[model samples]
Target: MEEQRVNELKDPSASKKDELLKRRKKQVGGAQGDSSGTASQGEISPEEAAEQAAVMRSQIHLFWGNMLFERSQIECKLGLHDWKKNLDVAVERFKLAGASEADISTVLKNHCSNEEAAAGHEKKVEDPISNVVDKGDN
Candidate 1:
């Protein structure tokens, strides 16, 4: 059995298999090596990093707000008859529009309960001056 094992170890196919495994290891290790190379490179300045972060935050906020507005519009058109399904559709649309899962949840949590509520909120957002004037003693 020992002699048979030694013979198998010397087989050309076995050597080829070993070569393939080593090549795979190198490919896997190369990915880590590239990341380390990037780490060794210079980092971004603090101000630049802060600016980038601010821009990203603004973009996310804008995306969330737009999704909310769109959701409200959809609710207004579809009415309150299958609200759960409508909210699901709105969430899916938000995902397709590049909203993160957290943003989707936040939007849902802050969403209006029915079409009437959605219309009221939409009107308030779309016409703040009108809302104030209407509330005033004309």
Candidate 2:
């Protein structure tokens, strides 16, 4: 159930995120503002642009989520570290697999940590402390 919730937060549909990103890309890059105050390269309105920008802003989590999806194989290949689990390896894999700093941070701190902890294999047990037994005078 928790996994389902996380997945839902991450938005499992790549295309939905992609479409938003693609539109954002066009808006930020290709869809430049017209000096003459008219739609130029794209037919998107200012209101639409604003809306897309807002949606894209909200959807930024998707970018990192998508990055995780892309690098999951590479991350798996790096395997886990005793101390850090696979996160360090995963982050490196992500970098090698072409993720940005922002992407790495988001993936590690946001998408992966809870899942890793909840998986329960990595639980650290506290070391047993020695008890000082008092010797009573006979």
TM-scores, all models, native as reference: 0.30, 0.27
Residues 58-129 of candidate 2: C-alpha lDDT, one tens digit per residue: 455445545555455355445633425334554554454344566456566554435666565434322221
Error in Å for residue 62 of model 2: 0.8
Per-residue accuracy of model 1 over 1-138 as CA lDDT, tens digit each: 777544432231344345545655665566557855653223544764665565455445445545555656566565756556656665654555445566556566566555467788888787987778888956
Q: Using lDDT as the measure, which candidate wins?
A: 1
* Residue-pair clashes per candidate: 0, 0
Clashing residue pairs in candidate 1 (N, C-alpha, C atoms within 3 angstroms): none
Backbone collision tally, model 2: 0
